[model samples]
Every structure is written in C-alpha cells, then in structure tokens.
Target: GSWHPETGGLHEAFGDITAILTMISQMDQCEAIICHSKGDLHAKTYFSAVAEEFGYALYGRTQGLRNADNDLTMSQVTEEVHDISQVFTGAFYDILADIFEDYCCPEKYDAAETLFRIGKHITSLLLQALLKGPSSNATFSDIAKLMISLEPKKKWKDMIRRQFSVRGVVGKGAKKVKAPVDLVWGGCHCS
Candidate 1:
C-alpha cells in the first residue's frame, strides 16, 4: 500500500513520531545527556518515558515506545536530522504562503503570524523544560512546573497550573447548556 500522509499503522506512525522527537532532542542537546555513558539504552529509556508522559498529557494515551531495533550511528542520525529539518522548514514556509494566499485579509494575516509566534514560543518552552529536567525519568509534572515558573504573567501561570492539574480528566464536570444559542458569523465564514 502506498504511504499516506494522514494515516498509517500504529507502529509505523509511532516510529516516525519517535524519529522526529529524537531529532528534536538532539537539536536541544537532550540527546547528549540521555546518551551519556549508557548510549542507546539511556536514550531509549528517556525517550520512552517522555513519549508516555508527554503523550498522555496531550492525547490521553500512554504509548509504550520500544527501542529501535536498528539504531543509527550518531553521525548518521545527525545527518538525517539535518536533512529532515531542511525539508520541514521548506515545506512549512510553502504551506504558510499558500495559507496566506487563500486567506488574503489583513486581520487574517496578523492572526496567522501571531499563531506562528505562539507555536514557536511553546516549542521553546518545551525545549527549556527538557533542558531543566532530569536526564532520565523526567515526568510531565516536572515540565509543567518549569513552565509555570517560567511564565511571566501570574494569570497565565495560574492557567498553566490549572491545566496541568487536570491533565487527563476528560469532561470531568458537567457544563450548563444554555438554550437558544445564537450563531453569529461576522464575514469570517465563507459563503
């Protein structure tokens, strides 16, 4: 079967996700700490824990990632990561340009730019959390605490804390549904 961008077997999808995370860890200098002395064993353990804890927080699923059967050499991994990064950057900008063209409005342009900046900020905070946490057995709570501490605004810090406190509770409390809801579309929805 041909490879599809949106769907794949669980193992295949997990492998690709792990590869991307591995590359990111390498870029953020986490690979060095995880691979110190213990090599692939430590890397596997660290990444497995990260995938499980971080994955559960984000998706409410604990993925038990296994060690790569054929681990790439350090140099090889570095080269592959570099290539992947280049391809990803090029594709990202191309998509962004297409999006800007499709939604040609000053307000939409500002919103898109703001979204990109927010994504970058979140990525930086994740990397910072990884850097500050323990080399092995770093839980999501550790990362969340780091984020709370790093957040400048008290309101945002409180929000982060609240979010972390309810990591996996899916709709724990019932919400009051208001009757006769009004749907207002202010020229934003395409006719």
Candidate 2:
C-alpha cells in the first residue's frame, strides 16, 4: 500500500481510490473507518461514501475528527516514514555500488545485495509492527532488536545484547540470564 506521488499518476490514484471503495462495499460488519491522509480530496470523498454506505462511524478530518490527527495516534506514520528512509538508503547504496563496480570489480554486487537485504528486512520489521498496532502490546524497537540479533552478523547480536544490558534486563525475559549464546541462538544451535 505504498503510494508514491511521483510514480503514481492521477489515473492510478483514481484506481486505488476505486479499489478501496470496492473493498469497503463488501464489508458486512464495519464499525469505525479510520482513514489517514483525509486531506486528499479524493480519499476524503471515497471515505465519506464508505462511512455513509456502511453506516460506519468515520474518524478522519474529512468528516470532522480534528483531534484525532494528533501525532501520538499516528505513530504508524512515523514508522512508515522510517521504512521509506531505509528503503531509500538501500537504494542509494545499490546505485553507488553499481557505479563503483562498473568502474572497479564487477563481482562486488554481493555487498550491495547484503546492504539491500538489511534495508528490506528493517522495512519489513517496521511494517509488521505497524500491522500489529503498538497498542496490541509489542514495541517495534523490541521486535527490531530481536530480529537484528537473529542476523548472521555478530555486530547485530552484540548490539542487541548491549541494548538489553542497558535496559537493565537480566535476560531476554526478566529472569536471570543462563547463557548469552543460548539467548542469541534462539533454538537454532547445533553441536
């Protein structure tokens, strides 16, 4: 559901708006429709129609929910923005690597691939966090620390361990830590 204003033409935006409306039309039991970016006239119109048709409460500025536009409730926006930043950082790294390889060693794409993978993984983690809304009782930072620890790089493992230590937590849980390697392995250890 990533929309780039530069890449998405007017027709594509219209199609997305139409598709959203079509999905809303099929919902049997919709309580509250929370539409972000209701500042867009097209989205506002589509959401208004959805609210009316489904008799669902609309909670967006388009319908007059001004107080809900505060920065606290829209944490997903910040997370998504971070995801986009990570994506761009990876893309920039790839582009630079491509240019370097064209003039230097042609087999250095692996480095770029690794960079891209890290960026993609970070973005995916943030997306999962967004899907599992923060109020559902899991912080994205904690999930990120866990995922980073699972990487093949020792740096990520040490980073997570250091973060856990700084937070004054004994182990992955609140109990005493038995072994650092055990917590870092997360059931994948052998031999």
The best candidate in terms of lDDT: 1
**Residue 23 in candidate 1 has what lDDT?**
37
Colliding residue pairs in candidate 1: none
Candidate-wise lDDT, in order: 0.37, 0.31
**Position 114, candidate 1: lDDT:** 35
In candidate 1, position 10 carries an lDDT of 19
Among all windows of 10 consecutive residues in model 2, the one with the lowest summed lDDT is: 66-75
Clashes of 1: 0
| Candidate 1 lDDT by residue in tens digits, 47-166 | 323345545676665543222222222122222332222222222222222332333354644433433433354456545765886554333344556866776657555555554444
Residue-level lDDT tens digits of model 2 in 92-181: 222222322333332653333333334354344334533543332233233434444454546544543443333323244422212212
